[model samples]
Target chain A: TTQEDPHWATPLSSFQGFEMIKILNDHPKNKSVFVHGKFRGHEEEAVVILEKTPFSEETLPFALSGETKLKVGLKNDIYGNYHGTPPAQVNGIKVSVVYPATPKHLVKYSQQQTYLVQETGDDYRNITLPFLQAEAFRIQWVYNILEHKQESERIVFEDPDKETGFILLPDMKWDLKQVNDLYLIAIVHKHGIKSLRDLTAEHLPLLHNILKKGQEAIQEKFSIPPCKLRIYLHYQPSYYHLHVHFTHLNFDAPGTGVERAHLLSDVIEHLEIMPDYYSKKTLAFCLRENDQLLAEFRKAGRVPQKSE
Target chain B: TTQEDPHWATPLSSFQGFEMIKILNDHPKNKSVFVHGKFRGHEEEAVVILEKTPFSEETLPFALSGETKLKVGLKNDIYGNYHGTPPAQVNGIKVSVVYPATPKHLVKYSQQQTYLVQETGDDYRNITLPFLQAEAFRIQWVYNILEHKQESERIVFEDPDKETGFILLPDMKWDLKQVNDLYLIAIVHKHGIKSLRDLTAEHLPLLHNILKKGQEAIQEKFSIPPCKLRIYLHYQPSYYHLHVHFTHLNFDAPGTGVERAHLLSDVIEHLEIMPDYYSKKTLAFCLRENDQLLAEFRKAGRVPQKSE
Candidate 1:
């Protein structure tokens, strides 16, 4: 749906109708899969005729509907074949194996049983199965397309396909749409500079160095550093996103109920858990975006402007 | 109520019976208008118990009766003295001009009606009669007591003619209770150390000086800083009561609706309304307590030699 339209109208096109599927047919690409779809049907003009109560009164419209399919096929290089890879025949997609969004064994099992579905083609050899439930899957796809830049030759389901409507494939291996806003609260040290200005000017790069050191320490100390800590430098409106987010992926596990809440508490504890001196020194590395922007202007071309 | 009481027994005594109250005759050293009462009820206990519930309980407990009215009271020096001076009848009677604990101005009003009642045996004289019609007036007494702690005295009602509660004299002033465990947050710049250990030094007088400075700053910053801020320095079986709390006093006015949700917001804004540098420095003063404590420890004190 286009946000500019009064009704936020969406357009519909077929699964085979998208452009990304053509790229999937080319075998040399290292990417694994691609999907695309489009959704249409909204009364934008009719909304203009009304008093705006029918549309503008609520954050989300009271009534809206659309249908789109996503076709996912592996790239030629992924399977070492010029054509599509042989489809993995499954009775129902095991959600845990595909999604793996949550950490709990029971939730993963339940999600596998509840959300997955096995779609059988006429020949059954080319059957398609999905990991997420119908509605959640659709929302995730739409959100992914909105976040990623448009490119014709990605592995994710891009553009249109025979089964789904107009949409784009996401570049990340995991779904970024389902993620909650992750925060890293760092306590600043190196006395006399409590304000944001002190942070970006002299502290953030120091923090980045500390964090890199800490990460290395963890590897050396534990002898098993994570393969994918999935740390990202995020910039947001309020926090200025100076902190680096750490998780399995960018996404936080949902449906963990008490576990998710506990995890949040534990993470807060861990961040503050550092020895007082180190904690303060490391936290100074994180800075708000506005402060970071100002610092960047002040330090332009001299050195990399670190977000405090 | 005792925490160990399995029956969840509530005290039979009305708030007037709390033992801490002092009769007007007992106070010869200081004289002013004041009254005090206590309700050692289980409201706080019940809340604590409920707050510590297990996450998967699936349901929350409904509050039983006798849970309300858990607050203490003091005499209202302002509205009760609305007539400028106390009536002759209030002599020696432990009388407190208490506004009901409910929302302020939740009482009814008459546009063009004024009535007078002769002062005889009635507790309060020449009250705005329209308040009787308002449902919320019944509980307005709580705010009155909390707001005017300085003007109220803790007096026990006594009568030779008929043994009963203490009497409230015309001239009495009261102070809030000074509990041994309570401590006020203090910020002092002269302390050479940076942490909690500095306060625990062998030089008690120096520690006292630091505390005095912090207290003075707190008073200079606010019109009426809380005299006692209870602290639980250590939380557990052998808990140390070393924490500091900033006392908060809220008064309800005409615009304060029955909800009173705006009280905290109003107080926060009021605190921030001070001159920018002063307010920031004051906030820093409060926040620096933890850092100051740590700083003290960093500069190790002289260790006493082992006994020969």
Candidate 2:
């Protein structure tokens, strides 16, 4: 079995006298090559041949905890299913090894992650998570570690990525998405400027010009009614950047909110993809989607009601 | 001193013995005019003179308790002293009406206020304070309320200036002025769109053109920057609106932070101001400010440290 698998590495002789042994590596499990017995002139070495196992939960001498963290080289053996049944004597023992997941959490590109902090200072060993995203990690006991008492002190983390890792601090912010048409509103939030005044004076004219020009450039394009869009500017107090959320609510349930939200998200995502060079079709689609979202919000009564 | 004031309206004398008095009117302090009387009749109104006393602690008797909110109105009495007094009484008890100083926790334009509601249903009475220029009446205990519930909810108060009352919620935001050179960098925790590729290729060119034109207009007219300038651009997960903050730090002291903050706040406040017609000076100021902020952020290491 060992010869058949060229990627296997030999095990250490320290396995002697152990009824159950477990071996873990940062690299993918497939590339690991295990050998037995000490090499020439080596006083300490293990003597055994590692064979591939068929089942994960049984048969293996040691049971795998499945708590292993990912690190470099973790991908090679990621496809294998081997359960380790380490002897009960290893129960309270702690073993530390660098894993691939450590660096991934430290610095990686993913929407699921908010921020990452690699170990810098000796005092705080664990990773740092912002108060907003920390809830996902199930670490509710972080409040116990604070010593100072100022309500205004901000925690700045050192981000190896962004020159300064401004530490993560807890903030109570209103989620605009929670209020009305989440997708329609979110698209507006993407544009930093708020208010129809800003939109007409700044975004609309430019956008119109771009769409008109881009429309001419593209082979297939559709006409759009500019006045059909109504924008309501909202200042997000939680976010540092002041942005305007465009609201184009239709009073009747002409469209479903779920579909509208998906369409809006897609349209905004498309807008973001090429903000400077938007095609006329893109503008037309966005206008069409926004019109639909407005209708949905109006039907849902999510928009604030005004007395005549 | 209370007898000679010409503004006093004599109280009715008919209801002299009545222990309970109730007056309902639209005016605040003048809503219901009542006087303690031993008799009950239309004639009792003569004894109830609305003699405005030298308002003081004696004029209003109430404790600043758990949920008792009052608006403190102060005026210069005959003695030239600022005498403060409660504007109204609820449940026959006078309460101190005061607006709290802006919270120390928030940087700029961020504060939380709580209105106590004695009842639940439609009968619930809640007086809301508007967020505007400093008024004589202020509310206390603002930030402490939002600290517990990490959500955004606001109490709307009627305003004569606008058709509807402004919605003021607890805003937890960062002020760009706090940083040196009036520049800010934010780490966007969204997936894909790494580097400046998304911004420059898609969003930047258009924005750059807008900003350039704005600066040119500013320079061509006022020959100076608009009063206090600010600029922002959205970047993702950590921040749904990733942005850069810029300010004119040249004219202010190195650490005063007040001017820079004002600059950013002003720009955000008036983002829609005459959007079509920005002066050359204003445009130049805004462009320079933006360039400075971006340069500062890069210098401060806002971008990824490792060059791929």
What's the TM-score of each model vs. the native?
A: 0.16, 0.16
lDDT of 2 by residue, B180-243 (tens): 1223222222223222212322333333433444334433432324222233332111122222
In order, candidate lDDTs are 0.21, 0.22
**Per-residue accuracy of model 2 over A1-308 as CA lDDT, tens digit each:** 26763211232212223221122111111111122222244333222222111212131112112221111111011011111222222111111111112324222211110111111112111211122234343222222212223322432211222211111222223133332222122211122332121222224433333223322322121121211122222211122222222322211112221111112222233244334322211110011113333233334443322221
Model 2 alpha-carbon drift over 4 Å, by segment = A1-101, A109-181, A185-308, B1-308
* Stretches of candidate 1 exceeding 4 Å from the true structure: A1-199, A202-308, B1-308
Chain A TM-score relative to the true structure, per candidate:
0.20, 0.17
lDDT of 1 by residue, A34-75 (tens): 111111242111100000000111111111101111122221
Can you write out model 1's per-residue Cα lDDT over B1-308, one digit (the tens) per residue? 47875322332211222222211111111111122222254222110000011111121011101111111111111100000111111111111122221222111110111111111112111121122223223322322322333323532111212111112211111132432222232222222322221123233333333334434544454333322211111111011112112222121111111111111221222223322211111110000112322222223321111121
**Residue A156 CA error for candidate 2 (Å)?**
43
Let me know the DockQ for model 1. Answer: 0.01
Chain B TM-score for all candidates, comma-separated: 0.17, 0.18
